[model samples]
Target: MLSENKLWYQNSRMEETKALLLQARQEGFRSIRLNLFPAAVAEGGVDAIDAWYQSLRVLVTYGNSVGLHMIIDLHESNRCGVDASECRRLTTDFWSRTAGMFSDTRFDVSYELLNEPKGEMVSQWGALYPQLIKLVRSKDRHHSIIVGGKGYSTIWDLPPADPDQERIIYTFHYYNPMSFTHQGADWLKAHPSLAERRNIGWGSYADRTRLAIDFRSVDGWRSRNDAPLFLGEFGVFKRAPAEDRVVWLSSVARMSEERGITWCLFDYEGGFGVEGLLPAIQKGARRQP
Candidate 1:
């Protein structure tokens, strides 16, 4: 989304991205998961898609060389009514095109079919997932795929894995009790009541307790399904108190590692990121091989 200037995909940003990747590697991070807003499958269609693919390939190739696994997360999907045939067609077609195109991507590359699916998309995931999985597996079998359930990939109501599907990883995003995370945002203050809260910070015993209980559900689901868990995204808003954001992220990182889950924070250059956050997480990590 930041690539919306007159230049679009500016070279300075690309260099900054590389620097961030190298920084993450220097910390204890093993992989990078990037959100994609559009694909060649939309708007300009094939030619557009091919151009996007080639541009991303350059980054992927460099990431592979540097030992950072890349997760290409399709963060947007057709979120229309279940009865709307157009929605399903749009999503299915996008994945079909995507999976076929990246069938031979390097081992370090993976795919996340959709991002934080909500509305009809989440409600009908069972019906939608199999179709997309079939299409992806039909075209590409080399890399792993990450799948998420309803409620914006929260622990609640996560769909279980079908039998014999071993390669798919389960994912969730955590910003639980958004009160503390998104505090003071004017956008969230559109309503009178929500605007009253001020300077909310993380680190209460109640906060820790709630987070543990929520994550325990994910732990249970993973045990039952035997699917690897990926904490694909988690972070407080940039507006949150720096101390609270750092500590909250560190706590979450520690919790994920204790359960053998892999995680990637919300962003590097974004608001949620603090200069010392990655290093802090790394310091506490088990450094699991």
Candidate 2:
């Protein structure tokens, strides 16, 4: 299951999106992450929104035919802007509408309530977290939902689970020691280097260990929190040296397996190219005798 942030509704055409999805499927990927933006759906008004839904129907319908699982990620609110109150309202409304949109589709799909919700502290997630899950489940009872902690979905921010054991999965993004993974990334505030280091693979090993530790702690908080875990995003910049990138990604795959976690590299093109990394990942995924 490969997950790429393919924001279909944003600055792209429907035919282009279909091509990308089909290409990904051809490249041995079974899943694609999609972000549905309401503002982008209809720049005009409610009438435009209906038209956008028609477009969505066509996209998802075609995606299903191609053996692609669409994980619909509700990303960025127009009104709420990452605040708790705003996130709650935006999440509720988004799920309510999205749930209705795909209710009839037979495609293998999942709902990611929100993408990297900010402003809320890790500890605060314990309080408002369950309510968010409850709200999503209220409308979409059968579909699985992905939930993550605050601080941009870092492993450090996941909340505990309750006794009822709802059908939810834990998720997080990994770009630890941000300087190395995000080098040359213009969007970030910092871009440090990981050059001049020996045993570079251990660096990613340690980062994955940190994620495992965080997951263990979350599990300890509530014994019933045994839901499967997935790494929704993790990638190194394209400019990084190929050797360093391979070592880092291999370590991530090994550590994730040791801890029983499923991880999908961030993308096919752009920063995370499977063409360059797949052979390395395949070697790493193999078990040593």
1-289: candidate 2 lDDT, tens digit per residue: 2333334543367777788779878766777777566644545778777666677767777787899888887766333444667566656666777777776647578887777666552345555557767776666677778887765777666655454756687887777656567666665433333333223333445665674565565345345465777787777776666677766677666656766776767766665666545666658657422
Writing each residue's lDDT as its tens digit, candidate 1 over 81-191 gives: 343365567667767766776677555778887776666665676787778788889888887888887647877756788778758988888888778776665666444
Runs of candidate 1 exceeding 4 Å displacement: 1-13, 39-41, 44-46, 77-86, 188-197, 284-289
Off by over 4 Å in 2: 1-12, 40-43, 77-83, 120-129, 190-224, 273-276, 287-289
- The C-alpha RMSD of each candidate to the native structure, in angstroms, is 3.7, 4.2
- Evaluate candidate 1 by giving its C-alpha RMSD to the native, one decimal: 3.7
Give the best candidate by lDDT.
1
Model 2 residue pairs with clashes? none
